[model samples]
Target: MSSGKEPANGTSGTVRRRTSTRSVTLRDVAAHAGVSSQTVSRVLRIPDEVAPHTRARVEEAIRECGYVPNLAARNLASNRSKIVATVIPSLSASVFSETLTGLSDVLAPEGYQLLLGYTDYDDEREEALIRSLVGRRPDGIVMTGAVHRETIVAMLRTARIPVVETWDWTDTPLDVLVGFSNERAMYEMVCQLHGAGYRRPCFVGSLPAGDHRARRRLAGFRRAAAEHWPGREPRVVDASGHPLTLESGARLLDVARGAHPEADVLVFSTDIFANGALLAAARRGLRVPEDIAVTGFGDFELSRMLHPGLTTVALPNATIGREAATLLLRRMRGERPTTRTIDLGFEIRRRGSA
Candidate 1:
């Protein structure tokens, strides 16, 4: 038979534990603060309107109970989400990280939250993310690039929210544009290298499919190379895919070396790739700027610190993010900007590597 003695209190047999599974509500906070629910709500929404003592009590109760306001409900009631959605290619790149940080720094001060999404350079994924972000009813949306699928463009038009596209420029943008022309920038970069007497240049970059920015750069590179070095076909190597990592860069460099060993100047789509090519050249016992000249786009910090310092196109990553946020914030406040496009141009950093 079972021992029928009910566990006595403090007898080390059994203890009754009360665990409240219910979520803390406004009424509970009001009860804890010894105030009406409306007073608690006022304290949360408009603290200055509530008496100082009441507000303090409500705040204390909130802290004690770890109360978190339902943002969705609040947003519905206010008809303002106070959220900005940003979609970029990849967070693995430091440029995108810097952009995000710049956006957060500006938006956080204005009581707005940033929701981030990564597309990994896929148009379909970008469209999906845009759809999801639109469903959240964000106050504004910031897209990384201007190039989007037709469906994405149509959705953006239908959503009717303030949109800012960065990283690349176009004559026509979805809404506000805050970026330099990748094509022109790369074209000018090629001119710079050519002017510096580095002939026989080759463009090494990812496959021209989802990455429209890289394709634009390649187009610029090809045009510049054809005009500068006639009769010699442009040595374009599709290192292929989103090879943003150093290992991928190194492997691509190996491919480039085997294909175009005569290339004196190698223009990479990214600094990470250039850095990898630099290491690959070192491993092959080749001297930088002597045996080969290395250059890259997006002057990452490593590009500056590397031995023989990588020559690269220095893009204003942080500025793009900050400007995009500023534009969105202006629109969020019911202010129309004088200009829809802001071309924050780039510069070519010439170093020993080139």
Candidate 2:
């Protein structure tokens, strides 16, 4: 009888060996680089400690072997996951997405990676995400917006890791804050519109229920309108329960005009809504500025591309992300910042649309 180890061809009694499908390990990298396993480990953990030539050789071997470091084991030994967790309202929005790009630009080069979580503008979801991320023992956490539930604040404080809040400013941040005053930004925009001799202004956007930023913006509009025109309540068209899209913006334009025909200007919560209104106006054979003026928050790229361009608030979205990452890095390195809050500020871009 033939042994099982015999070759399938049966030409000779030679045994066929099975190739290993196991992942490449540190020892394998060391062997490929002609160095010890400890040297490979040191090259990954502390490259400065190893010579330049040796570090280059190890890195080349790692690339050649497609070696992926075992982060779990490294985390256990160093007590640091080298991961930063970030929670934002929406990943599809350019405002938040640009901020993420800024974050990655600064953090990736520092050997840190991001773990992203989306809240869909839900407070409860945000709280749940924060709880889950904290449990993961991340080296740092970056949260969008300053307004958070008490439980979330308490959990973050107890975790004792570096926490950074971005996008919205607050005097009493949980740890560190990197954002501008949403209220003040909106307030200034209203004032600028008023200066341009546009009376009977109307606000259009989502309700201040789940979105704290939108709520603050609305408050600013009300405050400014009240101050500018005493006893005259600001007109608002609620776009709640609707996605902030051009289509929604177009529909809201018709609603706003129908509800308040006397309104001379429509100020949107975002450029997406404003752009939609502009398109809708054109389709209705209405002239801009002459028939009805339009303005928006967040100077999106499409804003400039739109006809007559969009008059909107230009927020430092990317700067907020970069600053938040830099601040988190400082805290993770056990360095205390001179100030806990960093306000990047915002600017109002007046284009032809208004």
Candidate 3:
């Protein structure tokens, strides 16, 4: 029998001494810097409190020892997580990606980090995400869209934290608004198409059960079409079975054309779907803008690169994200904006596709 402290024998009976690999702590950095633990804390927390030479020495020691501060303990002491929670429909989409990039650009410099969640455009999932995020006690919260369940709205209201509702315009914002009018934008899109001599235009998109914004846009288009082109029945295709993809767009356009053979133009809810529709038409030996005109929402990168250059509505995705982050930062710092609603409107880009 060997003592626990004795060197262990290897496979060949060669003696070997074990070494411990413990993480370097604050005390280690302090010892290496020849300073007290309090001084080391001050250097990290408020470098201005320490002399320039002392701060430099402590920083060098920290690097030499690879010392890392315990953020958990620090957060407990400061009562701040320095985290901003954001919940969006989906990150796979460029709209949300752009916004997230904008938020990170502004928040990173201020020592704030983003905690993200996806709701898959479901109200119940969003409610669950909200509950989970609120439980984390983040410094602020940013949510996409104005439409939320009553329980979600009530929970956010009761939390008393700064909340920002983005990507849609609403008079009764949960806290702050950093978005545009989806209804007005779609209405204007329909009017734009109608102005260009498209009398029989049909709307194609997913069902209302998943996307409330799409439903609102569809309503706006219907209202505008009724007012502008009365006596002509509007055509709508329920493409809700599949995810909002180019393939779905292609399939839905085929169905819409079949239902309304006289339809001269197709207005898609998104550019990806419109691209699919364009491909489908091309496959059927149809000439774009001559045989049938097509338009889409969200002027994403793919829209610009398309053969005919798709005519779509350009949204300020990154700008919305940056503005939302700025507003949250201001609110966190005890500053209030003169107005909470910041409407960054959309623009209709005319292209060969329409």
Q: TM-scores of all models?
A: 0.89, 0.91, 0.89
Q: Worst ten-residue run, lDDT, model 2?
A: 9-18
Candidate 1 root-mean-square deviation in Å: 5.4
What does candidate 3's lDDT look like per residue over 264-299, in tens digits?
A: 999888887898888888888889999889999888
Candidate 1 residue 214 C-alpha distance from true site, Å: 0.4
Model 3 regions more than 4 Å off: 1-22, 48-57
Query: By lDDT, is 1 or 3 better?
Result: 1
Compute the lDDT of residue 348 as modeled in candidate 1: 91
Best by TM-score: 2
Per-residue lDDT over 120-185 for candidate 2, one digit per residue giving the tens place of the 0 to 100 score: 889899889988999899999999888988888888888898999998989988889999988999
Total clashing residue pairs per candidate?
0, 0, 0
RMSD in Å for all candidates: 5.4, 4.8, 5.5
Least accurate 10 contiguous residues by lDDT in model 1: 9-18
Each prediction's whole-model lDDT (CA): 0.87, 0.88, 0.86
Error of 2 at 297 (Å): 0.4
Error of 2 at 122 (Å): 0.6
